[model samples]
Target: MGGAVSAVAISSILIANRGEIACRIIRTARGLGLRTIAVYSEADRGAPHAVMADEAVMIGPAPVGESYLRSDRIIEAAQATRADAIHPGYGFLSENEAFAEAVDNAGLVFIGPPAKAIYLMGNKAEAKRRMLAAGVPCVPGYEGDDQDDLAFAEAAQDIGYPVMVKAAAGGGGRGMRLVDEAGELADALGLARSEAASAFGSDELILEKAVLRPRHVEIQVFADKHGNFIHLGERDCSVQRRHQKVIEEAPCPVMTEDLRAAMGSAAVDAAKAVDYRGAGTVEFLLDAAGDFYFLEMNTRLQVEHPVTEMITGLDLVAMQIAVAQGEELPLRQDDLKLNGHAIEARLYAEDPSRDYLPATGRIDLWRPAAGEGVRVDAGVATGMEVSPYYDPMLAKVIAWGETRDVARTRLVRALKESALLGPTTNSSFLVDILQRDAFIHGEATTAFLDEFYTGGFVADEPGGADVALAAALLLDDDRDAAFAAAGYVSATQLGWSSAPLSPIPLHLTTDRGVFDIGAECLGAVWSVTVGDDLFAVALGQRTDHAVRARINGRTIDAVAAISGSDIGLSVSGKCFRFHRARPGMEDDAAGSSGRVVAPMPGLVVDILVKKGQKVARGDALAVLEAMKMQHQIAAPIDGVVTGIDASKGDQLASGDLMIDIGDAAE
Candidate 1:
C-alpha cells in the first residue's frame, strides 16, 4: 500500500441526487457528524430526501435535463451552502466524468472515483478495450467506433444472431435492445440509438453476444487513494424484467471458493487498471460451466449495494466518504468475511399486468415493514405525489439471516406486511418471485421470467372473503360516522338497538366484476354474505388506516386507504382495490368506444398514424416515453383514424385521449 496522502477535510456534503439514493447518502453523512444539503427539482420540493436534509436548495424544474443533471447548478448549491463536498448518489451526474471534473476544478471533494477513471470506465466500448488489455476475460463481440449502420449489420452477422445492442455510455436497461435475427437489426439499432441519445446524451453503440441464461453476478470492489483495494463478495442479480434487476442477493449461490477467488481477483485487477477509487462494481456474466466474462464496470456505487453491506457488515457509503477524505482502507481482502446471506427487492410504483407500465399518483398510504434483520430504504411517504419525471422505484426492502432460506422467508413476510396504496405497485409480484421453487432452490437464471411468465403477469382477482371484508369495513366506517353525527357518547352504541337490525346492502366493483354484498351487525361480530358464502368477521384492534379482524375464526391483519368511493386494501401480500358502485354511475358503453387513450402519464415520442389512415387490429399507432422506457401503443380494432388529439412531444396524463377510430365502413 502507498503512503497516506494529505487529508481533505469535509464538514458538509451536498447530495446531488434525489429519491431513495439521496436519502441513503444523507443518512450516512449525518451519522458521521457531517451536515447534509439536498438539491431537488421543483417536482421533488417536499420529497422525503429534501425534508430529511439539514438544508435544501431548489436546483431547477422537474425534467432532469433542467435540474439534477445540471452540474453547474448542483455545484452552485454546494458552494452556496458552504459545503466542502458533493455526493452524486447513484444516478444523474453520479458517473458523469465531466461533472466529476467540474467538482474537482471547483475545489469540492467528489465522493467517488477520479474523473479520469470515470472517463475510462463510463463508456462500455472503451472499458472493454481496457479490460482486455489487463488480461480480464471479456465477452466476444464488436465494440468498434464505426458509426455506420452497415458496420453494425455486418458486425451482427459476424457475431451470429441473438446479439445485444447496448448504449456505450450508460446502463440500467435503458438504450439496450436484444436482437434475435438479422431482420430485427435495423429497428433495434434505431431504437437503441434514440434511447441512448435521450438517456446518456450519446448515440455511440456497442454489440455483444447475448449470453443466454447467464447469471448476472457482480463484485463489489472498494479502493482508497492509498492504493489499497479489496472486494466484498458477489451479488447475484439474475432475476430481472425487461433487462432490469428486480431482486439481488449476496454470495451468489453457485459460487465456489475457487470461483470467488478468481472473479474477485479479476475485479480488483480491473479496478487497478483504471486507478479506481471509492466504491465501484465490476459486473460479469457467469455461465453454467463456471466461466465468467467481464460485462462492465459501474464507476459509482450500485443500487443493490445494500445486500453486500448486510452480509459483510460494512457501510459502503461511509467507506466512500472516508476514501474521499484521503483515508486508507480499514481492512484487507483476507480480513473480510461474509457472515450470512442477504437478499434485497426493489419496490417500484408500476403495474406488472400492464407490461410494467409506470404508475403516477398521490401515495395515499405508505407503511414500510419493520422486523429484526429487515431493512427498508424508502424515499416516499403518504400524500406524496409520484411524478412521471423520474424513476418508478419507491424503495428497497432487504433482509438478512444465517441462511439464504431464512433471508428469503423474512423478505417475503416483510413484503406482505408493507402497505402502499393509491398507485399500483409490484409488491405482490415480488412476493411471488421470492416464493418460486426455482428461486428457493437457487437455480434461477436471467431467463427466469421469460421461461415462466411468457404471457406476462396477471394478478389474481379478489376472493369472496376479501370482497366481504371490504364491504364490512365500509359499513362499519359509515356506522361510526353516523353515530358521531348523532352525538352518541361512543361508537360502540352504533348497533345497540333492542330489536334485530336490518342488513345493509352494497355493490362493490373491482376489475374482475361487481359484487352485491349484504352485511349485518350482530353484536360484536358482522355476518357478511357475498352471493352464497357467509363469513363471521369479528373486529379486533382498529386504527384510522388499519384493522385486525378474525374472519371465520381465522385472524387476518389488513390495511386500507379510503378516498371518496374507492378503497385500497392490502392483505396476504396482495392488493385489492374496490369501488363502491353508485346508481347511475355505470357507463353502458365504456369498452366499445373505439378510442385509444394513454395508459399512463408520459410524453408522446412518435405518432405513427395520421387522421384518415386505415389501421388493422394490433397495428402500431404511436410510441410513448414514460419513466425512461418506451411503450408502443397499438390499434385496438380495425378502423380509420377519425381524429388525433395528441402530437409528438406532447405530455399526456393517464386516460387522456390520444386517437379516435371509427368503423372501417365509416
Candidate 2:
C-alpha cells in the first residue's frame, strides 16, 4: 500500500451523489465509525440521504450539470466539510478521471480506483485495446479512433448488420443505439452522436457487433494498491428495457463452475491490466454457444452491485473506502465464497405502459416489503416528491435464497407486496417478469424485453368487488367503525342503501380503460357484480394504511390513496388508478376538439410535424426529453394538424396543449 505499512485511517467521507446509492454509501460509512457528509442538489434537499448524513451540503440547482456533475463544487464541499475522503456513489462524476485527480490534488482520498486507472478504463476504445493486450477476448467490432462517419458505416458493414453504436466515453444505454439493418445506420449514428454529446460531452463513437439475444454477464472485481485482486463471481443482467438493465442476479443461473472460473479469471486480468483498485465490474456478452466476449469495464461501483454483495456477503462500499484508506485486501481469492443466489429488481418512477416514460409526483403512500430474505434499499419516502430533474430509479429490491428459484420467488412476492402510490412505478411489471417461464428457466437474453414485453406487461386488473371495496374505502366516513364492523350483514341493513335508495352508479377510468359498475347491498351481503362475475366483501382490519379484507371468502390485503375524485389502490400485488366519473365527463371537450397535449413534463426536443400536416393515430407528432431519456408524443387520433402550439426547445408541463387537429370525417 502507498501509505503506512501497517494501517491507514479515514475520519470522514463526503458522498458525491444522491438517492439510494448515496444512502447506501452513508450506511456503510456509519457502520465503519466514519462521519458521513452528503451533497445534494436543490431538488434533493429533502431526500432521505440528506437526512441520514451527519453533515449535508447543497451543491447547486436540480440539473446534474449544475450540481452532481460539478466536480469542482463537490471537491470544494469535501474540503469545506473537512472530509478526509470522497465517495462517488456510482453515477454523476464517479467515472471521471479529472474528478479523481482533483480530489487527490486537494489532499482528499478518492474512494475509487486511481485516476490513471479510471482514465485508462473510461475510454471504451482504449479499454478494449488494453483488454485485448491482456489476452481477454473482446466483442468483434471496430474501436478505431477515426472521426469519419463513413468510416463507421464501413466498419459496421464488415462487422455485419445488427451493430451497436455506442459513445466511447460513457455507458448506461445513453448515447447508445442498436442498428439492425444497413438502411437504419445513418439515423442511428446521428441520434447516438447527438445524445452522446449531450450526456457525456463526447461525440466519439465505437461500433460493436451486437451479440444477438445474448445474456449480459458481468464479474465484480475488487483490487487493492497492494497488488492483490479477487473476483466475486458474476451477475446476470440479461433482463433489460431500452438497453438498460432492469433486473440483475448474482451467480448467473446458467453459469457452470468451469465457466465461472474462466470468466472470473478474465475479469481479474482485465482489472489488473489497468492497475485497477476499489470496486469495478467487467461486463461480458455470453452467447448461446457458451462463449463470452468482453463488453466493457465499469471503473466504479455498479448499480447492480447489491446483488453481488448479497451473494458474497460483502459490503462493496465499505471495501471501496477501506481500499482508499490504503488498507490491504481484506480477503484473498481462495478465502471468499459465494453462498447463495440473489436477485435485485430496480424500482423506477416511470410508467411502463407509456413507453416507460419517466413519472414525477409526490409519493403519498410508501409501504415497502418487509420479511425474511427481502431487502429494500429505497431513496424516497412517503410524501416525498419524485422530481423529473434526475434519474427515475427510486430504489432497488433485493432478495436472497439458497437457490435461483427460491430467490426468484421471494423477489416476486416482495415486489407484489411493496406499495408505492402517487407516482406510477414498475413494481407490477417486475413481478410479471419474475413469473416469465423464460426467466424462471434461466434462458432470458438481452432481447427478452423487446421480444416478449414490447407492448408492456399489463398486470391483472382489479375485479369489480375490488373496485367496490376501493370506492368504499375512499368514501368511508368512519375507518374505525368500518373495521369494527367486520362481519357479514344482511343487504337490507348493510347501510350502503336502504328503503327506496338506489344503488350508486360509478364510472372508473384507469390506464387499462374505463370500468362502469353499479354497487349495492344485496339481501344478505354487500355485493358487487361486473359483467358475469359477482363478489361479496367484508372489511376485516385496518392496519396502518392497508386493509385486510375478505372478498368472496378469500382474505387479501390492499391499500388505497384518495385524491379528490381519484383513487389509487393496490390489490394482490397489482397497482390501479381509478378516477370517479363526473357528470358529462366521458366526452372531454378539449379531447373531442382534437387538442392533443404533452403527456408529461419535458423539453420539446423535436417537432416531427407542422401545421396542416395530416397524420394517423400513433403517428409521431413530436419528441420530448424527460428524465434523461426521450419520449415520442404521438397523435391520439387520425386528423389534420390545424395548429402547433408548442415549438422545439419549449419546456412543457404535463397535459400542456401541444397541437390541434381538425379532421374531415370521423
Candidate 3:
C-alpha cells in the first residue's frame, strides 16, 4: 500500500467514535479540507461531536455492543456516507484487528496501522511473545496456552508474590487484577476473566511479575507505510487510579538524554518489527535504576496524545491522515525536537469521595478554562446529559509551559478556573494531586495513589464562605425571577420595603450535611449568615453562565448555573452543589433505612443474596455493570433480606432499590 499505485485519494472521512476524540479528529480533518462524517448512538444524537461533523449518521441504540462495537453497522454507515476513510479514535474498534480488516475489505482506508500490526499487538500474551522474539525486554511472566486454574497458581508461585493477572486483549485497566499472594489468585482470575470477556470479548489470561513502584513511561512513535519511523519522546503517566492514567505529561521529568535515546530506539524497533504505520505508543515500565522493560504497544492514538502534540508542535491526527494517504515521513529523527513541557488532566464525571463511582446527570454548567498555554478538549456543554452508556471521561485539560513547574501550575490553575457542575467530578481531587509534593517533585510512581491516598480521596467539607455564597446566589436568583415576573420592573423598586424585612431563612443541603442559612437582601447587596459567620455579598455583572461577586470586600469571579431549586457555583477553583431544602424534604438515610440501592444507572450482572438471607455489614450483595466496569453493591448493615426488587439482567437507575433488608431480628 506504500507504492504510488496503491495511493487512495481521500476527500471525505468518517469518524467511528464519539466524544472529545471524535471532535478532535474532526477539527484536524476540517483544517485539511476533508469532509467529516460522524456516527452516533441514540444517546448521542445531540452530542457535540455529532453536531460538529459535516454529516452524521445514526448507527443504533445506546449500548456499545449494539452501536459503537458493531463493525458491520460502522462499515454500513461509512458506505452510506460515501466516506473515503474511517478513523476509529482510540477505545472501541481502534485496536480491533477484525474491524481494521473489515474496513480494508470494504475498500475504505483505515486511518491507522495495518490489521496485521493491530493483531500482533492487540493481545498482551502474543505481543509479549513477539517482543521477546524481537529481543525486546519484557517482564518475566507466563503466557502459555494452558488456561487452567492450576496453571495460573503454579505461574504465580514461580513468579513470586505480588503478580499481575492481565487480560490478553485488555486496555484501559479492564480485566486486570493484582494478586498479592496465592490465596487471592483464584478470585482475581475469576473477576479478571469476567471483566475481560465483557470488555474486550476475550478472557484469555496472562501472568506477569508486578513491577513494584515502576514509572509508566511510553514513547510516541509514528511511521509511514514506506518504512520510516521515529519517536517523538516519552510521556510520564505515573499518576493513576484503578490502573487508569489520571494525569500525563510529556518529557518525563526523570528522563535523561541517554535514557530517552535508548527507549526511543527500542520503541522504533518495536514499530519496525511489526511494520506498523501511523501513530502508536510503546509503553514501558521504568524502574528507579533507569532500566526499562517493554509493556505493550497501543496501535492507535492514545487519550494522552494531546500532551505529545503540545510539545511537538505537530498534529498527530494530521500525520495519521497523511500516512493513510500513503505519504512519506515528514521529517527524520535528527530533525525532531521536544519543545516545552506539557501536562494533561482528564476530567471525568465521577465522585472521588465515593471511590470514583461514575456519575450520570445533566451538565448544568460547562465553562472550560481559556488562557495562555491552556487547551480544553471537551465534548460536553451546558444542559447536556452525561450518559452512563459510555466512558466517564468528559474532557481533557492540557497546559504547556517552558518548564515542568510552569506546566504543573498552569494545569492546576486551569482545572480550577474551568467549571463543570451538576454531576460530581474529579476536578478538586485533581487539584489536590497537582499540589502534592510527590507529584510536584516528579517522584511519583505507579504506587503514588496507593501510597498517598490509602483510604481514597475525601474532599474537604464546603467552608462557611462557600455556603454563604450559595445562599447569596440563591437569593439573587430569586430577586431576578421576581423582577422578570413583574413585567421588567425597575430593580431598585422590586425589593424595596417600607420596614425592615426579616432575613429569609433557608436550608441548603450538601454532601457534608444540611446547612441553615439566612439571607437578607438590601437593595443591590445581600447579608448572608451561615452558622455564626456573616457575609456581605454584592453581585456585579451577572450573566447566564457566570457572575462577579464581592464577599466581604474580596471580589471573585465564579461560574454559576441555577436550575429550579438546585444551584451550582464555582469559585477559586472549588465547586459546590446546593439543593434548597424544604420542610420534611430531607434525604433519607439509605443505610439506616435498610435499603440496598444501586449507586448509578447500570445493568444488574449478579445477585449474591436471596430473600430471607441474613447478611452482615459490608457483605457483597450484588454486582452492577456500568460504563464497562463492575461495581459491587455491599450491605450497609447486618440484616435479613426481606425482599429482592431487582433481578439479574435488569437495567436499574441511580438510587433504584435492589434489595430490602429487615432488622436481623426479623
The TM-score values for the models, in the order shown, are 0.96, 0.92, 0.97
Question: Candidate 2 on 1-666: residue-level lDDT in tens?
Answer: 355444458999999989999988899899999999999999888889999999999999988899999998998899999999998888789999999999989998899999998988888999999998999999888899786888988999999989999989999988799999989999888778877776788988899999899999999999987888999899999998888899999889899999999999999999989888889999999999999999999999999998888888888888888888778878998887898899999999887866787889888788899888999998888888898778899999999999999999999989988998888899888988899898899989998998888677665677777776775554342322444485534332353333322466667776555666655544333466555676676665566777777778888788877776777788877877778775345635333557888767888988999888889888988878888877778887889999999999998988899998888453
Residue lDDT tens for model 3, 490-548: 35345452333368999999866788888897777788988899988877777767788
- The most accurate candidate by TM-score is 3
Note the residue pairs that clash in candidate 1. Answer: none
lDDT of 1 by residue, 46-117 (tens): 999999999999999999999999999999999999999999988789999999999999999999999999
Q: Which scores higher on lDDT, 1 or 2?
A: 1
Better of 1 and 2 by TM-score: 1
Model 1: runs farther than 4 Å from truth? 490-504, 520-523, 584-593
Candidate order (TM-score): 3, 1, 2
Per-model lDDT: 0.91, 0.84, 0.91
Looking at model 3, which ten-residue stretch has the lowest summed lDDT?
492-501
Task: Give the CA lDDT, 0 to 100, for residue 618 in model 2.
Answer: 82
